[model samples]
Target: MRTGPRAAAVVCGAVALTASLVAGGAGTARAASCNVTTGPYQRQVEQFLGRPVDGRQSAADCEAIKGFQAKHGITPTAGYAGPLTWQTMSVMLAQRAAGTTPNKDGKCPTTVGRIACVDLTRQLSWVQDGATLAYGPVPVRTGKAGTETRTGHRQIYYRSIDHWSTIYDVAMPYAQFFDGGIAFHSVDKSMWNPPGSGGCVNMRPADAKAYWNLLRKGDDVYVYGRKPGT
Candidate 1:
């Protein structure tokens, strides 16, 4: 089928219909059979996808599923939570629940105090306080190449509630400066459409503020891997 926004919408509609059909037989048995064996995983799926936990694969759920599938590298983008999608989501959910530790080679630095573990490869970043996850692995836009974001150990050295760049002349709100010029700040969410950052970590406004509240001066920022599309 033709792909892009229109195709995605069509797929979502089809998935919603499929889910509704799977929920029921014909007429009299509809309400009774509507509940699929989605179980706790279904709830997790709904919550993870930011859909209402209504115990059904809703239209919203279907679209969100498609988005989740694309983000996590799931195949087909069919908008259905089949075995593969469920399994993949389960593994990721488990990881998020438990928090991420570096692999054997130590791509992430293990720390006892508060630290921000950024997985540049996956475009996800989270904050942990001595193994306790304080924030998120939410979607982030790191620097593009040439202005390549320097990896390895760093810390939040300064912050500004509303910072204006004299050099770039752009607003860098909720800015927490790390690595000299690089900062963990909020920019337009639409910027992720093309995903370019000037060696700074750009997040959504709410996420940036949340990070500001969670982190303070001198907190560790552990950046790892290379930005995938950069």
Candidate 2:
């Protein structure tokens, strides 16, 4: 049976992915991918940084965005030219005009290959794939003072796509368990900071999804430092 070309629309909250329906049959129609930002926008972003805006988001553009994000302490470190990335660039441009020094990411372990970093003091997390950063420096809420997220080297042991916290009775999605019952999963930002996770790493939904993509079972999970505020 031959199926005619049909428009495909999939929406995940604010993230929308629309597939292209070319003039041909299934062979010509392109499958959809979740990409909110694009080349032209990336080129516009490059303009603010004194680079030639060729109206294309190139690999250099992606790296430049990552560099800007890292320099401005943006989270998730995703290469997309999203609102946050643009906002950071705008702020920096303004700051430069005012002759003020700009802020950047704090610190992380200098390791090879891929590694996910969880910084308690900064309340942020990021994934660095070799010298190339794959995701985040995004905001995160970890276990409270008494039950702070374990600090040390650990490896992911299990991954539960739709995990539920039996003890807390909460939904833990994209859960990658590394230390016992504690894992990296999405959580409500409202109940975080002062009183956060029991002993798990609480991430934003988007960040959690990004982490799920970047990490694999047996991957290194280094949890270190402390979130300053309660």
Candidate 3:
């Protein structure tokens, strides 16, 4: 993902992809893929971000937003829909629509592909393959009533194993591209499935582990609220 905002408000490059093996293990081979059309989650993601769900926002695209936010010292709040966040989100959507993944950060990993959609409003997660939507309800802890989760597109730019928590070792990154240091990650059983986090997405032990397994360093993760069309 490219750091710093662009002078103009145009979108960024295409969705570029490269083949690479993760550090600890090899990932599953790519299956015959198809175009992912708009779905319930897609619509919700857009609505949460206060945008339209017209099949935009890819995994790589979201990751770029996170990268930009991280570079600028923005809190990883996992919610971005303001001007700065929109600036990056629009650029990434354009890049994905073009089917070219521009290499802004040459050092960043490009193995992980883009996410089809996320429905923060519904507290659900889905992985798309073509028109088929494979989804499940993911328990998350959003910001308090006053500190509601930001609504917008984002990506997973970081991950950690064996965190300080004794329950979960996996942590999925979802920082607000230009908000706060809040993020979503796997947590201990005691804190899973409850709206009690400091301002991060919390998941059950098993669910977090499963999500961690499927995620990579640069995966897109979107979050929003329970709004119409969201």
Candidate 4:
């Protein structure tokens, strides 16, 4: 999948683009100069975004940083290397460091057969068969602040490949309901979207489809930790 916001359009059937189209169009405009004042995480943000990593702001650097900010719905989207942006990057780095053994800490119960592990702390999800990683350490967008995704051990209770959310009126493809209305599904928005999902674990279309294929009813689903902003 494409990491940049523009890639969202490439995955048309996966995400509902009605609102994001407008936002994406606006993101094309040149960022203003007000964001020139570099914050404390300048070096880190620069390095993460693959900018020059000079620890100093430049016009090109601002544009690159702003693009990343826009992708994550970070406020201002003005390219400032701020704390929140750096914190998000840090979580991503940790997730990458986990590599294949995302459950090395054993927070997810290995006793269960064919289980799905959700690490809310890193906003990542993966499937496990015994100690083997059957699938992802893929990026995900989980529940937002007051509506945080409930943490605990649960199981897949329902499966709907093409489900519609009557409450939110949005398309939820490859949905696997594990807790109440919350499920693992694909959304039209970026997984890096700020504030997170309504409660479900939102994934990319491809990742959701993989989950749909790997998991089924009664499979264990273990979700733990708290989402960053939540």
- lDDT, candidate 3, residue 185? 49
For 1-230, candidate 1 gives per-residue lDDT tens digits of: 55432332332233223323422332222222222234445666787677788767766676676676555444445456665566555545544653444333455655648888776665677887765666765767676666667788888887787766443334667877677667787764432323245577778888989999999989999888876545
- Candidate 3, lDDT over the whole model: 0.37
Which 10 residues in a row give candidate 3 its minimum summed lDDT?
Answer: 10-19
- Candidate 1 or 3, higher TM-score? 1
Scored by CA lDDT, what does every candidate get? 0.61, 0.57, 0.37, 0.77
lDDT of 2: 0.57
**CA-only RMSD, every prediction:** 13.8, 16.1, 20.0, 7.2
Error of 2 at 173 (Å): 0.6
If the candidates were sorted by their TM-score against the true structure, best first, what order would they fall in?
4, 1, 2, 3
Tell me the tens digit of each residue's lDDT in model 3 across 11-124. Answer: 111000000112111112111122233332444445544554554655533443344443333233223323444433443343344232222222222243544233344344
- TM-score, per-candidate, Cα-based: 0.55, 0.52, 0.38, 0.84
**Model 2: per-residue Cα lDDT over 134-201, one tens digit each:** 77556676776565788887878877777654333445678787776567877544212233455677
Runs in model 1 deviating more than 4 A are 1-106
Sorted on lDDT, highest at the top, how do the candidates line up?
A: 4, 1, 2, 3
lDDT for model 1? 0.61
**TM-score of predicted model 1?**
0.55
Which 10 successive residues of model 1 have the least lDDT summed?
26-35
- What TM-score does structure 4 among the candidates reach? 0.84
